[model samples]
Target: MHAPVPGHVPADRVFAFNIYGDPRLTEDVQASYQSLHRDAPEIFYSPLNGGHWMITRYEHIFDIVKDYEHFSVREMQIPRIENPPVFIPLSLDPPTNLPYRQALMPHFSPKAVSAMEPKLRAFAADFIDEVLARGECDFVHDIAARFPVSVFMELMGMPLDRLRDFRALADDYFKARTNEEIGALGERIIGLMTELVELRQKEPADDLISKMIEFQVDGRPIALGELQSMLFVMFLGGMDTVTNVASYTYRHLAQDDALQARLAADASLIPRFVEEGIRSFGVINTPRLVVKDCERFGVQFREGDMVLCVLPLGSRDDRRFENSAEFDIDRQALTHLTFSSGPHLCLGHNLARMEIRILTEEWIKRIPRFSLKPGLRHHSRVGTVIAIESLPIQWPV
Candidate 1:
């Protein structure tokens, strides 16, 4: 069984607000780390999550993530996550990870994702068209969040209208403040996923969900619970990630007209902007358990110790980056740790990159400018996943 981290919290270190206790820990994470990384690059244990070792600097954190043999993904997930922790292949170490990833790899390849682009672009364009005439709307509800939800639903061959229904629970699941609440959200998504898997098993549509159901492992069909969990993870990862990326860009660009103009002037720069935006706002505060005792970065960890790596914080580490704190879109910072590093690097990364790049390009191409509406407050919460609750904005009709 996993136990709380054992180490002394440095006297100078101010404990970060537990990402689990409160959802607000995700927003402005850099500022939070800057407060801690000075005196302690690696906190012995954080008060958050019962004081797991918090990796604040880039070298130590990425090095651990890249070296999977020493730092395993098993039991990396919190027990409170919605789906049973079994679909946690992304959390799995190599050799074992290879087969599970292989089974689902076909769905996210460039060719497969590219085939869906026309449909995705059309969906994004239609979404833009709806909001373009309105002049003012919450970009989160109105655009940024909606596009990926619709795309994932379509990709899974699920009903498009059910987007709102799934999103309602998804938002709750991702923002679940308590372990009990997270479990309830998981039950809800699992119920929906069960229905989808059963239907797809019978119908076998030409979509990712059906393809996954047909995915054979060890000469037998993968079990329904496993398949459902995979679908749930896929839905959660795809929908939440792209939406957050778009929201990050819009929130930042809405206030920075000069930066917006620079991108608008050269649409080709949108990819770089998206990459940088991810570097700035990407939220994968995942943890890994040590397979055996190991030493790195002058710190030694014993077997079974949980090591938590904050991805975006590492991207800003001054040692690995030049002027790391500055948010220069053009700053070539070794391709940010946004998507993560090494073997278990996010599988949906290519599709996510394409979706954000195209959506940013299209949105800026049509709605060139926008501003955050006055008197409206935008709230960002950090949990297992970081998210923007609402983002209201106005642009020319």
Candidate 2:
């Protein structure tokens, strides 16, 4: 445990332990972000893990990510790893990342994702109908979480029954405050993935996992350990992220009747609104290592130094937009760093958009009006990825 350096986060703010715990569930996270921006402009050091620099400014973060040569994603802390840690394509730098990414791109291409839309929309409709019939429900657990997790499972050919288990494992692994807690959950997920990988190897199927099993580099298959890590990363990353985006977007849209009505009236605008929602609800801005001693935002950093980039803050940067803080669905010429900027930009971005688009459209078509309960409480967990535990909303029959 690290102590906060007096004035570490600026005079106006107090740090919230779970800023990423479940981004949609917490209110204090916004306060912490505001404090960092208003008082500590360039960077604020977190007391977590003896502290690491958290960059909130837009240009500062963009500059860092854009110049991959300066900031490397390699060597990032992955919950339960020791010296000479396990790293996958996501954790790899340029040349190494390029091949694996190329090998996988054909699977997530525009044509490929477009082909998935019909199946995804069918899934979305069924998911929405389940909640709409109830008249009221916990959006996160019942609907938001279910849709993406199920879709990903179908895409990956994982047993749909294990969706809840996977979520539980991922939540545990990500929200673990202690190393022991993380290790216990992480090892379990690895075991499960390993079993699935072995089973798929024995009798291949027409799924993403099977495809990975079939993919080769230099006339040999990609290693099973790396494949398991890759799949695990995809599972956890996609599930919580889509869930948070859905929950936050619902919360934000419901709060402003005018905005909600606008979206409800114009279904065509749902996609744009979803993009803005993702931007505003920007979850994780993971850390990157300073490959070599370098100066960023005028601050000198050592070779092995770490830097945290908050995507939401960067999305709300005034330098990038006319009004960064204000939410504008119709805001033309909007460019946000929520998905990040660079080679390591989210690979699932297209799929994420498709999921959100299908979800929002189907949701509005069914339940066009809703509001938060008078005294609903939100639960947020801030970790490497921010998430929403539950989003409670109500609608008429």
Candidate 3:
């Protein structure tokens, strides 16, 4: 039951923006995010997606994310879910969430990500090599889509041969038009994960699945159901985040010759470029369940309403970062909530940075200059994680 929305929030604030189905989400998402903070308050109610509160400012978002007791991450779905799948660490609160996060931390820390750089670079180079001679190719398919999926498959102990097939399924899963379609894809993904899990039980390898098999939470063996949920989160994240990030970032770079040339001449600046790119173009509106009645940020949040913490808008808040709209690599405050904040901060952040950095370094090194094919704009869809449709580009042979 929703407590009455405070009288302060006006009916005009009910903007009909649907993050999942909006075409503008992929086209000019930056402008779209800015519109939230344009004339609206820090938080507003959007009746779209069956009614939810949209958090528009960085300070407000940070507060709610830090206090999970009031704003629970358990129900992350936009439209919300009944008996949602419990994604460990991500879905749990406080002490219970710590151990699961700890078990996975070592693999994604800076040290581990650094160690994997060589292989990651090789993967990036090989992907770039495939399309260098063509002078024009779909950057999404040739590099952005495949490279991360390859690494994701390795990390999860899935077969590399299924890379192409998995990409197709992931695209469908994120862009599904109906609930039944989403359900079918979910079952298929879970089935594959189940097969991998069962295989690891009999024959463990030196992969994440093997480690999960050996991990114990709460001083006891992790439950199968819990383990599956963790894998499910990994499955969604692994295939989604970097794919859109790389496509969008590189697509931007492709169009900006001066920026591309600058990065090409001095590769050391690639990290800053990655940070700025994420800060500028990051897309992902995370949802949290209102566990109980509470008035936060001068807004009345009820027990059952969903609060969407729009990170892209929050990170770019001018109060936090001056000149927040423009992508300035040398910006004094480059930090952002692109991966989110607090206990639920993304553990995959280091790995994601590594992927984007390597791909940028290698792509610029090979094809130092490129641009979108004539008038072609890369396509994308807004959903779970915004999926980049295609990034076709051309350069001098």
Candidate with best lDDT? 3
Tens-digit lDDT track of model 1 for 223-342 = 877777778788788668789767866787898898889888998888788787777777677787778787776676777566778776787777877877666787874767878888
Candidate 2 lDDT over 135-169, as tens digits, reads: 88888888888898888889988999888888888
Q: Which stretches of candidate 3 lie over 4 Å from their true place?
A: 1-12, 23-26, 177-179
RMSD of 3: 2.5
Best by TM-score: 3
lDDT (Cα) of model 3:
0.81
Q: Rank by TM-score, descending? A: 3, 2, 1
- Global Cα RMSD, each model: 3.1, 3.4, 2.5
Task: Record all residue pairs in model 3 with backbone atoms less than 3 Å apart, i.e. clashing.
Answer: none
Question: How close is every model to the real structure, measured as TM-score?
Answer: 0.90, 0.91, 0.94
Task: Evaluate all candidate structures by whole-model CA lDDT and list the values in order.
Answer: 0.74, 0.74, 0.81
- Model 1 stretches with alpha carbons more than 4 Å out: 1-17, 21-32, 77-84, 177-179
- Please provide, for model 3 over 132-250, each residue's C-alpha lDDT reduced to its tens digit, 9 standing for 90 to 100: 99999898888888998888888778999988888888777767645567678888988888889999999999899989988888789988887887887888788878888778888
